[model samples]
Target: MKSFQELGVSKSILKALDEIGFEQPTPIQEKAIPAVKSGQDVLGIAQTGTGKTAAYLMPIFGKLVKAEGVDPRAIVLVPTRELSMQVGEDIEELLTYSNLRYASVFGGVGWTKHAELIEPGIDVLVATPGRLWDLYRAGAVSFKKVKTLVIDEADRMLDMGFMPQIRKFLEVLPVKRQNLLFSATFPEKVEELSHEFLDFPLRVEVAPSATPAEKVSQYYVAVQNYRTKLNLVSHLLKDEETFKRVLVFCKTKEVAEGVFKVIKRKSEGEVKVLHSNKGQSSRINAINAFKNGEVRILISTDVSARGIDVSQISHVINFDMPQDYEDYVHRIGRTARANEKGTSISFIAEDELFHKDRIQELMRADIEEMPMPSEVEIIPISKKEKLAQLREIDKQKRENDPDFKGAFHEKKKREPRKHPTSFNPKSMKLRKGRKDGNNKKR
Candidate 1:
């Protein structure tokens, strides 16, 4: 029941908090502000939408109060451009009563304006890894005066392979600075990085690592194909009782586009899509539209959806199952946020049943399967057909090799890509084309 006032935060921050009606501090903010005021590194592992941003932000502002005007004193590294902007907005809300200035620098935007915003005293800098590194290498920004460093959503940085970049940033920055790492899920890598960046840090775990928010009611529906999964999703939405603000997850940009087209035709209105394949400006606009309630349902692939910060999602639907166990946790976490009850409905095809064991192991609970809805037609998969499907999958390896060109070229030295077991088999199936006369399965 701690208030922001009792947390020993700066009066300016308290004023801003009160003005914004954020009177009570969440568990993370209550614990994190003090450790940060002491200038100690803090490692906070908690679920998303528990007001995690304010947990690290208020304290950073508290430390930066040694001045009146803008001067860069803190650095927050995020995984994507959208997240960088979201963090900037959060900081702006917290510092409305103060004279703090923040610069959000990320790729794709014009460099001149970003350069002007970041250098020679921007006060607080929120940036994506690539843009920050580019600025650092170009001598446009300096970390010499950075008093605090925050790695928000540390798990995603690892997922996107930004560890080396993070390590490089750490190497360049002053070694004697306060470090904070926050994430919805704390995988082993997050803990390992904690030891490297934090010094006897005050660790805060408000929720267990990798656990979804409390408000979401979880369910997994077993199916046989993408079409079946889509049918189940459509049925849930059409069910009328639980169809508000649904967010759907797909694995790739191409697949997201395809599913979006299918669902857009299936739904009445309020359906939208966001993915990396779209231009950055379009993606930003789509997300803003979704946040503003213009779009009731947002269909997105993993990468583009990584930085979404919406808090009032009613349900999260996994149209295509994620390959990684951790991704599954994050996808479902979109709902049940901000202490509100949410429903996470997952569709598992029959062939994809193999992935269920791993997902169940991750959740530490058995996923209950609802019988196929009679009203929503579900086409059945015959055992004979499935066996024939497996045999075709087995025959594909020798028959299809795109690199061979004409089946007489020398072997290439390219290494194969690592795809998810569920999707990888499907990708291999596509690489092996159908039985056509001229269009051979090359």
Candidate 2:
């Protein structure tokens, strides 16, 4: 409960924080600031929406009070282009009264344009791994002056297969630099990365790994199929006053598009969809519109789960359960942010029940089950959809028990197949006569 000042934040940064309305430090910030300020490598484990961005940024900003040198002195590597921009915005807000220069670089856009932005040099650089490597190889950036490196969302970076690029950065950077790695969940791969990336780093964990935000009220509605899930979402969103500024998460681009079309047909407010197939400008516009409250509902895949930083999101609807259990935490985290209370509703279909169970096991808690509203019609599952669900359930069962063959396998075994012989009836008769004659002779 200590103030940012008590955490030994510099006066200039304190004024900026005060202006930004950050009065007290979050648990992660309170514990992480001092450790980072001491110039020790830090490994922080906290869930999303817990002020983890500021936890590392404030201390780094305090240390780099004034801009110096031509090349960047500090680098913050993120997993997605959206996160790079969001972090860049945060840096701009925190450096309002300071002279530090920064630039955010990422792919999906021309590297030449970003190169021009960093031409005059920067004190801090926030970048995605691929674009950073591209710029470095093209001689648009340098890592000689890097004194501090922060790998935010380490688990997400690993998820996106950025380990090779990260290793390259580590190999080229100065060995004496400070390393700060932060993640919402620490899977085994992330742990292994930390060992290789950090040197005697001090560990700081504010909460248990994979734990959802405490302020979010979570519930799930049992759905029969995809169409039923859509019906439930449309029904709930009818309460416009209560479901304002919501995010609807789907597991794939096709599902997201389908949800967007359905919601757009019924919604009175603005609706948008985001996924990998979206063009860069489209994705940016969708995110900006959602953030500015111009869009009421944003149907998206997991791309925006950790990238968005909006605080007033009223609800997060999981249209489809995430295959990865850890993603459930990030998906729900999109709603409740900056200590604001929010709601998360998940639609658990028959096949997704296994995923729901895995998520509960990761969170160590069960999501409250809510009864379906009488007014909302529950569509009967189609035969094809029922078969798909059965197949998925069988796959999940096989994963849990290798010896247990699925229903399809048992069905195939029960129906015997007849083999055709090459010999005709005449050849069979001749062979039988010869055998009988031999027996009589004996």
Candidate 3:
């Protein structure tokens, strides 16, 4: 209910906010801006579309009145290049009236451009942990003046195994600085890392972590196998009236590409695929196409679950359920943004039902289940899919009992590694020595 100005935001930022049409602060922003301005480390937990990025940035910009130092004043460590770009763009939008400069450094691009950006010095730097560490180690960037260190998407950083990289940054950064850790979800591991990174940080939670947006309607369709799931996706996308501006999330890059191919062949709408395998330019183009409405459906892996900020996303279809339960919240968060109502449909294969139940348990709300359409053929499972399912089942068994070798484990252990008997070089020397000894004895 409070305006940005009422929340202690400066006149310049307020003017820029007005121009950007940010009429009022979101719940997380309302709570976080003050805490950040108080010069205390903050552990902020809110859903994806709640403007968490701006929450930290506004305060950082408010305090950073000018570009004073050759080194960056604030360093925002993100988990992905897409998020680095997103945060950088958000900062640029908020700096409409300020002379402060910020650069987004991430992998999948030439370091030359980033070196050039860092050489001139900037007030803020948004970066992925690995690339940022690389730049700093290469002496292309400095953090001596970095008074504020932000670990955005801390949970995702842990998921992507960037804790080591983040730790490296912590080692190199000044100890006498403010630390802010923000995340959509706070699993135990993420919480542990937050404790390690922060110094008596003020905990801020606008909504319970793993809680999906209330405005988004969630549903799931039961399918027998991967092919059936693809059929279901194709069927749903055909209904353009409701599924406009849709986003489909797959569990892996292979699944994402498969879904994209199937949808491209079956549906008449424009479609794009996004995954780690895609080139940076292709990923950017796909995201731009989706944002600009050039593409009606965007199929992607979990990579885009947190980075994308497209409003009016009519639907987010989980072509494959996310392995991480927290990612379910982010996948659905893609829709129902900016106070708009949206829908999310998930395709649950028989093997993925347990994952679905885990997600529901985390959300404390069961996703409404819908029957698969009769017309959509339940295709026979391919050998590859069958093997994948077996592997998943084996993995689950192993999780319950570490001693449980997988379905293929016994076969692998029993199978003999072949070595040619006639060409045993290891014994040939002994045989020759024995023959020589026999000759000498004779």
Candidate 4:
């Protein structure tokens, strides 16, 4: 493996990297730095933990640090606020040896503060689409001086319906600027957008798109229901040796809150819940606590799965199976980062097995199933749980074979409404005659 210095990284930036204990470049960074430096548009395919942020940031810094710019030379577009913050922090760390201004602008916060920060001009601007667009409209940002435009997590941006905003940026920004599109997966929509956005881009991929990190040991435990899954999570966390610095992903905010309550009550360690329902400050606090080792467990929804950049995470627990198969990859990618071995344990109920099957199909590897721990008692499946399972199976069948509705699918029979005065033809004619007679008298 070649060192960062061998990749044309400057001594000053190398010093900063060394301070951060980054010695060798990861595969994505190793291959992408050159391509990014070459100034051609790049379509990079790499998972979250593959150092893709540094891949682009290194070359960007090498060029920007030498030049004097005021109007934001590089703009990185991220899908979520968390990602915007993560990428912004990476940029800050990379520029520790340089005197460059960078700001992370995202929603869930007032724009006035960000506007004030960027009004004086920024060298690097990391922002989400909505807030960036808002800033641009507010005349707080300028794209004329932007030399390089990066759309990180491009697939997620598309999934979140930021195509129009991205196109708006393309329309407003300088056409001569370089473009870099990075994503974990390139779905049809993402591919289509790349064609529209990039010009003859060099493609760099460290692994097949949507493939989970190989270092993550993935396993699933079958459970009876949500309660049992909670019990299992509580039981597993007792082994602090293996389940340190853990992230628990749920499919919904309510489930995440429930799991957080359960773990907080059962475990003696610090635990927090993160989701859209929580305030922005709370969410950020939860992430910081987890990252700083102040919190032992973080229960979150898919919102934080891909955006979190914490290192040394020992485990990722899927409290609920992700509805989107691609998310399973992102959830597990949270761990096994920085070439560290990590474990991913998923709690699967019978109803959620199909989701697991879809995830396995996407990864092209079946996760090993483990017997439930002896401490977790197998409670009888509740009727409500069984009905929910049936509904989920029905939903899956409908997705696969539209015509085959499951047993739980009962189309509501609508009773036709009856008009009080026009139930029959004779009554309708009499009403019409009375109306005509009244109009004639008037």
What is candidate 3's lDDT per residue for 1-442, written digit by digit as tens? Answer: 7888888997778888899888989999999999999999999999989899999999998899877767899989898888888888888888888888889999988787899988887999999887887787788998888899999998888988987778778888898999999999989998899879899999999988789999999999888798788778888888899788999888898888888889999998899999988889998898888888999999898975558888899999888888878988988998998789999988887678878888989998889998878888889988888888788877777777889986656553577789776865676644233544564422
Off by over 4 Å in 2: 410-442
* Global lDDT of each candidate: 0.78, 0.90, 0.87, 0.88
lDDT of 4 by residue, 144-181 (tens): 89999999998889888899889888889998999999
What candidate 3 gets wrong by more than 4 Å, as runs, is 381-442
Could you say which candidate leads in TM-score?
A: 2
For candidate 1, give the lDDT: 0.78
Inter-residue clash pairs, candidate 1: 71-123, 72-123, 215-342, 223-348, 223-349, 223-350
Give the TM-score ranking, best first.
2, 4, 3, 1
Q: Please report the candidate that would top lDDT against the real structure.
A: 2
Candidate 1 error regions (>4 Å):
66-71, 239-241, 380-442
- Model 2 residue 438 CA deviation (Å) reads 43
Residue-pair clashes per candidate: 6, 0, 0, 0
Better of 1 and 2 by TM-score: 2
Q: What's the alpha carbon RMSD for model 2?
A: 5.6
Sliding window of 10 residues with minimal summed lDDT for model 1 = 401-410
Better of 2 and 3 by lDDT: 2
- Those runs of model 4 whose alpha carbons end farther than 4 Å from true positions after fitting are 403-405, 409-442
Score candidate 2 by TM-score against the native.
0.93
What RMSD, rounded to one decimal, does every model reach?
12.4, 5.6, 6.6, 6.4
